[model samples]
Target chain A: GPKVLQIPSHQIIDMGQMVTLNCDPVSNHLYFYWYKQILGQQMEFLVNFYNGKVMEKSKLFKDQFSVERPDGSYFTLKIQPTALEDSAVYFCASTGGSSYEQYFGPGTRLTVL
Target chain B: QQQVRQSPQSLTVWEGETAILNCSYEDSTFDYFPWYHQFPGESPALLIAIRPVSNKKEDGRFTIFFNKREKKFSLHIADSQPGDSATYFCAARTEGADRLTFGKGTQLIIQP
Candidate 1:
C-alpha cells in the first residue's frame, strides 16, 4: 500500500503568521492535492498540483495559499497571513494517474489563534 | 451549494446487523464514486469504489449501490461488527477531474 506522510502532526500558530505544511507523498506519484476539513465538516478540496503547476483550485483556496514540490522533494502547502478561520486539519493526497484513487496523509491539524 | 449530500449524519446499529448509508450528488458529470472510512487517529482510507458503468461493487462486507439516473449511491455494510464503527465519507469524482467532492461524513456506531 502506498503511504503519504505529513510532518508536524499538530501546529499552533498566531493569526496572520505564515505556516508551511509538509507532505511526503508516494515516491512514484505524479499528482498531488491539498484538502481542508473544518471541525465536524466535510473535507473540501483546496488545490491540485501537477508538473510544477496548479491544475485546479476551489473557492476555499484563497490567494494566501500556495503549493509547491520543488526539485522532486517534499510537497509543501504555504499559507501566509493566515486568518482565524484557517483553523482546521489539512490533508495531503497523491495519485499516480489522471483518474484514480488518491492516498491521503495523516492530516496536519493547524490551529490559528 | 453542496455537490455531494449524505443522509443520516449518524447511525447506530446492533452487532451482526446491516448498516445502510445513503449519498446523493448534484453533478451529472460525476462518474466515479469512492467510499472512504476513517477512525480516530487514523488517516482516511478508501474502502471501495464504483464507476458509472457498473450498478454495484462489493468488496468483502462493504458494498456500493449506484444509480446513475438518480445520481445517487449508497454503501451497505452487512454483518456489521463493533470494529466497523467509524466515520464514513462518500466522495465523487467527475470525469477527468482532478479533485473529489466529499460529503459530510456519517458517524456509525455498532453496539454489541
Candidate 2:
C-alpha cells in the first residue's frame, strides 16, 4: 500500500507563534488534503490542494492558515499566529486521481498554549 | 451542520457476535461511501467502501450495505474479534470531488 508521511509526530507552540506541518504524500499522488481532528471529535476537512492551488476549503480553514506544495516538494500547511482552538491532531491525505480513496498519514498532533 | 451522520456513539459487542455500525448522509450528490477504522493512537485506515451503483460490498468479514434511495449506509463486522474494537468513521465524497466529509466516529468495543 502507498504511504503518506507527516513530519513531527507532535508539536507544542505559543499561541502567537507560527507552525508548519509538512507532509510527504505518496510519490505518484497528485491531489492533497488536510484534516483536523480534535480529541473526542470527528475529523473535519480543512482544505484540498491540487495543481498548486486550493480547490476547496471548509470554514474551519481560518485566515491564519495556508497551504503550499512548492516545486513538487513536500506539501505543507502553515498556520501564522496560532490560536488555542487550533490545538488538534492534523492528518494529511492524498489521492492518485485514479480512485476516490485517499490514503492518510500518521497524524501530527499540534498543541497551542 | 454535519453532512454525514453516524449513530451509536459507542457500542459493545461480544466476541464472535456481529457488530453493525450505521451511517447516513445529507448530500444526495455523494456517490462514494467509505468506512475507515482507527485504533487508539493511530490514523484512520480504509476498511471497506461502496458506491451508490452497488447495494452491497463485501471483503472478508467486513461488509458495506448501501441504500442509495434512503441515503444511508452501514458497516457490518461479522464474527467479531477483540482486535476489531476501534473507532469507525463513515465518510462520503461526491464524484469528481477530492475532499471527504466524515461522520462523527462510532467507537466499538468487542468484549471477549
| TM-score of every prediction relative to native | 0.98, 0.96
DockQ of each: 0.87, 0.76
Q: List the candidate 1 regions with Cα displacement exceeding 4 Å.
A: none
Compare the candidates by TM-score and give the number of the best one. 1
Superposed Cα deviation of residue B44, candidate 2 (Å): 1.0
> Would you give me the overall lDDT of model 2?
0.93
Query: Which candidate number maximizes lDDT?
Result: 1
Q: Residue-wise lDDT of candidate 2 within A1-113, one digit each (tens)? A: 88889999999999999999999999999999999999887899999999999999999999999999999999999999899999999999999988888999989999999
**Chain B alone, model 2: TM-score?**
0.97
Fraction of the real A/B interface contacts present in each candidate? 0.77, 0.71
lDDT of 1 by residue, B1-112 (tens): 7899997899999999999999999888887899999999788999999999999999999999999889889999999999999999999997877899999999999999
Instruction: Highest DockQ: give the candidate number.
Output: 1
State how far residue A59 of model 1 sits from its true place (Å).
1.4
Q: Which regions of candidate 2 fall more than 4 Å away from where they truly are? A: none
Candidate 2 lDDT at A87 equals 100
Clashing pairs in 1: none
